[model samples]
Target chain A: MASNEEILAGLAEIVNEETGLATDAVELDKSFTEDLDIDSISMMTIVVNAEEKFGVRIPDEEVKNLKTVGDAVNFISNAQA
Target chain B: MARKVVITGLGATTPIGGDVPTMWKNALKGVSGAHTLEDEWVAKYDLPVHFAARCSTPALEVLSRVEAKRMDPSTQFGVIAAREAWADSGITEIDHDRLAVAFATGIGGVWTLLDAWDTLREKGPRRVLPMTVPMLMPNGVAAAVSLDLGARAGAHTPVSACASGTEAMHLGLELIRSGKADVVVCGGAEAAIHPMPLAAFSSMQALSRRNDDPEHASRPYDRDRDGFVMGEGAGALVLEAEEHAIARGARIYAELAGTSVTADAYHITAPDPEGLGATRALKAAMFDGRIQAEDVVHVNAHATSTPVGDKPEYTALRAALGAHVDNVAVSATKSQMGHLLGASGAVEAVLTVLAVYERQAPLTINLENQDPEIPLDVVTSARKLPAGDIVALSNSFGFGGHNAVIAVRNV
Candidate 1:
């Protein structure tokens, strides 16, 4: 099992694929576009990654509520729980 | 015969510049915004493409950190451009019910999506960001612009792939002409320069990879053309009914004369090789404008430079306009700005209106040798149009075989 930090690091690979930015735990608090320069289409890739990783598909209705990294992490955690 | 919709004000945040005036100035000067991207993933993942057209002017420069943190780059751009358009209209007092917004994007929230994925994969899902969805919605731009303008009429988004933005404009025209709203802030936005899309497009060979020379990679209509260069930004226009605009003393740029849209229903990413869908759209638009085909001498073409994509537009024009096609001078602005995907049409429409208003059609850049098969008078150099005001048409086609046309004439 991975530590929370390891889990976050695993998530970074997803962000890296979507954003083209290979970030670390230090950059997790960063806004997607500002600190990391990720664009809109990249977010869709993240949702897809979370869905596959957590085995829970977030629907379009709930997808609109996500705005930050924490939101995605919480959504996945809650689903996995 | 019916109510006419006209452009009152315009705004844009593009790769070359931010705001309407700056963007227009840079566009006329033929500035190239494409640059080689430096990212760790390029080395780690070994992504094929090495460059993209990032906004020379970022939205954050005009927005606060708090404001910037809330929206995706696409929505941030929409709000920035919309605010500029509203201020440019010189209408300080507006009735909320009479105002509306229509902003569309091909893809949205990519950054948020990917970042959230990273949070879940490594951080055990509990550490994922909270605002992922809000930042990534496809209608985020429409929501932002509508809120900024206090637009009560409605906020609509038409996501028809690359044609999304132009479709939004056409919808805005319909809204005003149908008496639903007196004014509409309309445009398109896109921010998809991330590695996944880059890799996806690269795999499809839909992007230019001449990494050595980013500036000349987006060569449309040239015999050596390979693929388009992805670009990011937004373009917006303020449109109003002639009566409302005149009563409010708004400066009318040009009349939204007519518009038409059609779908190929053929290929998901390719046009009807014969230009069937495009021909129908052009004919309908010309008929709607109530103008003879001869009157339209200029076209702000949607030439994305993909070898297969550039030729069909010319074929469609020749089939649709026949003899009039020879007299038409096509301006492929994508030649300079790469392709803004969904926002390309709206940006070109804004440029076309300026061309008509200024009586100077900016030439297609990077067109050293035109393809011999494309039999039309493409304006290779910026030239002043001859006397006499006339109707001009804007065409936008999307990946899903969706197509839209808009006609503008001097008021």
Candidate 2:
């Protein structure tokens, strides 16, 4: 199982890639839409990329709760468990 | 008197180079861009032809990931080239209502359509991406370019096979002459190097099969020539009315004197053996430019290296220029760059404009033993052109009996 730090790094990379944000700017506590200014399409890309990287199937309904980097990391960690 | 149109900016992303200056430099040095394909699909499908002239720099290198993901390869190439041309023109501001786009593609978004079909077959239609329709649309490039530049006058895409690019140029000229727009950004792009097109072209005996020597496969006018090598890229130019360019103090490349588009109405695939439509197009361009054959010094012929296809262009040249065809420095640029399909005309038009502006014509490479039947003065080296006022013509013909020719004069 991947550690919380590892999941955070992966989330950071996808967020930066999909949103075109600075890598250092994407933190665990940052809100995806409010802080990163990511749109729905970008959020979709981020979810897809994270799903691929972490070997997890993120259901569409669960996407609403994963609004921040911390929320995504927690979801993936719990899903792995 | 009619308004004059001049080429103020040029851009290209081709197999020879990523940008206009580099492509032009490689062209002057007689560089060939053909290479064998390394894609696994080649072996998986056992494709007959194993080579292509891909863009020297892939579109992914220049376009942002988000932007690149949304567009098909054809649209990506068009956007890249258009951005370069727009920046090169040095135009800071213009009325959005007076700007327009005229883009072309021989076969649009082949990769996108095929990929979608493959996904549909393997994973069901539910797996297909939502962006497939816009990505695969033939007019996607023109629409994307129009949106990129905020062009409000119009956005047009002409689909005339290989002649599409030149036809776009012809349309741009007409738009300016008709006072529809002050500046028209025009060009063509093609990204059809997928397995299906390769197989189709190979089945039709239209692609070269020199698998052993890919670099020398595209030998236009050579006796040993077999067929054209498929190439992919895009070329763009900013065409502004003479008054507009002069008023802005833009650096003009060459005056787009005249352009003509005609149809053979003879065959769907093969050109008219007598070159009737081609001759008419050439003659009409000269007449439209008010330039006599004697004043024309060079021609960028659309010689695609096929045995039958190469001869008719010569016939058309002789019929159009008479004895002066002997003096015109004919250039078969496909000898080095391969056939760019619809993009060929716009690229060759850029080269012709450069030749006229720089007073140096690029050579026709790989013409080892020139065909005796077609004995026009094909440029064999970077030959110096004559000084004083001169005119040049670039000819592009395509399947479906379409013919397009543009006349460029030194400014």
Candidate 3:
């Protein structure tokens, strides 16, 4: 299972690939929509890619709860565990 | 009085060259863009035809990674060409609400659609990208261009197969004449050079099978010609009202005199054998422009190198222009650039505008023996036109019996 730090790094890479945002700027506290400026379409793309990367099932209902990068990274870490 | 429309800027990413200047230069030199296909799918599918005229420069090389990811290849070509056209016009300030786009395509986002289908079959639908719908739509190019230029007046997509591009120009002219928009970015793009289209066109005998001699495969009026070679690219023109262009001190290329569209209503895939629909379109375009046959010094023919297609176009010219057809210098540019499907008309329109502006008709290559039945004054070499005021016609006929013609005049 990926550790919390490793999950954050992997999620950052996927977000960077989809939105062209600098990986360093994708901090755990940054909001995907507000801080990162990722649109809903790109958000879905990132979620799917993140699921594949971490082998986690990120359901549609759970996507809205994971508002910030930290929420996504923790969810992915727990799902992997 | 109707507002006069003029072509203020031109852009193209074609098989022969990536920009208008390079494309025009290569066209003047009669360079053929056709070559054998290099994709692995060719051998894997055991396709009958294995050649196409791909863009000289790949889209990924020009567009940003993020931009290319969201849009389909067809939209990418349109965006590239439209951006060039917008920059070429040198318009730094314009009312966003008064600008418009009339981009067109024959086949839209084929690669994206097929890829999505494959993903659905293998990955059970969850893996399909959310962009598939937007990318696969026929109006995606128009929408993308509209967004790129902040055009709010209107965004239109005319999908008449091969005539789609010319139809877009026709629509652009009307949009300005009707006081709907001050500036309209008009053009067409096509990137259907995929395995399915190749196999489908080959099955219908619409593509040439000159795999060994791909360069000479698209000989428009050659006696031994078989069929057209597929080509992929985009062409764009910035059209503005004459008063608006003059107020901005824009460098006008030529006046977009008139345009007309018609339908064969006879056959779906084949043109009217009697060339009735095409003749009417040609005559109407001239009449709309108030031009006489004698004033028309040149023509950019829609001769796609197909055996049956070349003759009807000649018949239409004869019927429309009467005896004056004998003096008109005709250039079948598909002989050099292959068939760009929907994009053919827009690219040919750009070339026709250049011809009237420079008074030079680009050469039509690979005509060793012209078909005796349809004797035209084909430009076998780079030929000069007469000085003083002159007019040129660019004819584009598409599948589904759609016919479109545009008349351009020296300014």
Candidate 4:
């Protein structure tokens, strides 16, 4: 019912428990450790769940490629396209 | 030889009671800690297993709404347990660097995560709260405990399925022995009693469904055994180096001599049928303690009520300790306390330490029928050890093929 960007923005509500940042925080840029304070473990779960939810076949290594909310939204958009 | 570590404080939030005194009182009196859930899920979804060993009381009864809103149930239980342990330790002022925390959880922040998902689906994107993530992290308890104690040595968390708490205490021993911390707060917490988790576990055939008689529902090692009953709570201990405890005139509980963990890398849901990992973990703990199997007087076994999970632990203990199996009095505590998941092993370890200190071992409830295949000295009611010196071992194995055992001796 929602656009890919909107879906991603919605999913960001899952929140990174460590830093309390919405994965979709507009300020949440590509750099995780620096900008969002999301550690590798939290990032791992977020990516895996996002991949599953969006049907985006994120590869094992490529999951780390996503750095920002925009990047995740792009991946989801491209996959759904 | 390594520096000795001792338990200076203890805390638990369990079905029988919320604090150590109430839990211990009920535990000693052999009161049943199992009960039915009044949750909306019971009538809404018709869950096959409607009963569980909930905390003896609600969390909000002890913690403020501000604190409750900020933390996941697991972290809140952890904070309550840790607060009790810290208060028990008697020392108010501590060097932030010298103090450390190692609290663990098998399933952390599930409530927060699930609630956030529901919010996202129902309320839309912008309406989701900002604090969902921090409230649900597995390390949330350790972080909160660290913040509370101003601990800077490290806030370590080991998510080894159900064995998480035992491993946490084991890590505390290492932290103190490694000279990285003079005093360490350690334990395990689990609050995964939500409808989804319960239904999921039920679907996996891992939960006991005898809802009518909740108290007798969790029957481990019995012929009528179905599966483990889910429980939620936390347990914690304040561990300090002997030198530090002695300097501060703290009452030493017992010496935590050795601890070791190993991975089975075996199965996803089921334990290794042979329990080879558990065997090695026992060996490692004893060898590290420089103690022999003959010295272990009692054990706290990780005996969840699944059909395939109970016996391997006994077989492994037998293989590792050999004929001394007759001497080892085993207490499958989950029979009474319900399975605390991550908190189970740690809470059992606390019970084990209390047994060693007081010379009294708690009873293994609901063990009506001992599996003929399994061979061990399981305490039926309560066993009083003779007034003599003794050593003990507490074993905890997890879902991800993780096995951890810790050895303790009279201080």
How much of the true A–B contact set does each candidate keep? 0.00, 0.08, 0.77, 0.00
- Give the alpha carbon lDDT tens digit for every residue of B12-115 in model 4: 89877799878776665665677899999877998888988999888999987645867899999999999998998898777888999999999999999999
DockQ of all models, two decimals each: 0.04, 0.23, 0.88, 0.03
Poorest stretch of ten by lDDT in candidate 2 chain B: B123-132
Candidate 3 positional error at B98, Å: 1.0
lDDT of 4 by residue, A1-81 (tens): 348667566557644433456454644355655666676756665665665566666665776777876676777777778
- Which 10-residue span in candidate 4 chain B carries the lowest summed lDDT? B123-132
| lDDT of each residue in B1-411, candidate 2, tens digit only | 999999998989999999999998988899889999999999999999999899999999999987898899999999999999999999999988999999999999899999999988996764566678888999999999999999988999999999999999999999999999999999999998899999999999999999999999999999999999999999999999999999989999999999999999999999999999999999999999999999899999999999889999999999999999999999999888889998999889889999999998987989999999999898988798999999999999999999999999999
Task: Tell me how many clashing residue pairs each candidate has.
Answer: 41, 0, 0, 4
For candidate 2, give the lDDT of residue B141: 95
Q: Which is the better candidate, 2 or 4, if ranked by DockQ?
A: 2
Summarize candidate 3's per-residue lDDT along B284-351 as a digit string, tens digits. 89998999999999999999999889999999999999999999999999988899998999999989
Point to the candidate with the largest DockQ. Answer: 3
The sequence of per-residue lDDT tens digits that candidate 2 reaches over residues A1-81 is: 899999998888887666567888888899988988877766776787777789887887998988888898999998888
**Tens digit of per-residue lDDT, candidate 3, span A1-81:** 888888888888998888788889999999998999998899999999998988999999999998999999888888888
Q: Give the Cα lDDT of each candidate.
A: 0.82, 0.92, 0.94, 0.83
Error of 2 at B369 (Å): 1.5
The list of candidate 1 runs beyond 4 A from truth reads: A1-81
Q: Could you give the DockQ of candidate 3?
A: 0.88
Q: Pick the candidate with the highest lDDT.
A: 3
Ranking of predictions according to DockQ: 3, 2, 1, 4
Model 4: fnat (fraction of native contacts): 0.00
Model 1 C-alpha lDDT per residue in residues B20-45, reported as the tens digit of each score: 78778876777777888887877787
